[model samples]
Target: MSLQLPDVVETYFAISNGGDLSQLASCFCSDATVFDENKTHEGLAAIEAWQHEVRQAFDFEVEPLQALQEQGQLTVLTHLAGNFPGSPIRLNQVFRLEDDRIRSLEITPC
Candidate 1:
């Protein structure tokens, strides 16, 4: 399927909800990078490994609240929820897409 910036975010939530690492990996470039919380991960291999590990821990949903785009990037506001108290977490996802795959993602809690 052809991927777009919004598709990147939606696919993330979908794969995450299904706990599918392979599907998640497909959304990224081979050298895609992700910055979450305070940690930075380089490459789809690392992102896939990280997702595999973290998916076992958190069961949050990437509930899209708002979305904005400029140039070739998209910034999405979402709610993350799971096992923790006050589980519903608000966050922002900044996505940069290259050839329809996510080239970079920066996530920050709101």
Candidate 2:
């Protein structure tokens, strides 16, 4: 089934697919956090840096397939393909949003 995501989540995917770090950074709150690759990046600056590093290191695209919301969190299943070790993979991106901004996000293999 297709999931109807929040505006913030939709914006996140849009900016991410566009590959605009600056616009992506604007999708989060000042104290937002991102958990990926066993690392936690906190705050906007760190998030921007992490995005920059990852974007530069791998040429990739993310296609959000579905989303599920529980409590205050939303988990989205996405298909990612890139130049990384595993060329293509499916992952779950969990997002916690507050005040129309993403407060935290965690990504894991699906």
Candidate 3:
């Protein structure tokens, strides 16, 4: 079944997949933060830089397998495959949206 996602969230996945990184400003709030790999990236510039580093290092594809949203937070279970040590793995991405834009996101092992 196709999971329904909010417009901003959909745009986020689109950007992550193949869309232009310049479009990130439209998808994330100026103060957005992303936590991954034990590092916290704050602000759009930092988030973009983090994305660039991860995309360059892993070249991974992320597919959302399941999702649940409560209040302003959405948690998605994703399958990732790439050049990393583990060819494939599952992770949980928790996103907090504010004013229709992503305010924060935390990625952790499932």
Error of 2 at 30 (Å): 0.5
In model 3, residue pairs whose N, Cα or C atoms come closer than 3 Å (at least 3 residues apart or on different chains), thus clashing, are none
TM-score of each: 0.86, 0.91, 0.93
lDDT of each: 0.79, 0.86, 0.86
Q: Candidate 3 versus the native: TM-score? A: 0.93
* Better by lDDT, candidate 3 or 1: 3
**lDDT of model number 3:** 0.86
Candidate 1 at residue 43, lDDT?
86
Query: Cα lDDT for residue 34, model 1?
Result: 92
Output the better candidate (1/3) by TM-score: 3
Give, for candidate 2, the lowest lDDT window spanning 10 residues: 17-26
**Number of the top-ranking candidate, with TM-score as the measure:** 3
- Tens digits of per-residue lDDT, candidate 2, 37-92, equal 99999999998888888877888888889888899799999999988998799999
Model 2 misplaced stretches (Cα beyond 4 Å): 1-3
lDDT of 2: 0.86
Tens digits of per-residue lDDT for model 1 on 6-97? 66667887886764667866799999999986999998778987788777776666667777898878988888888856778898888998
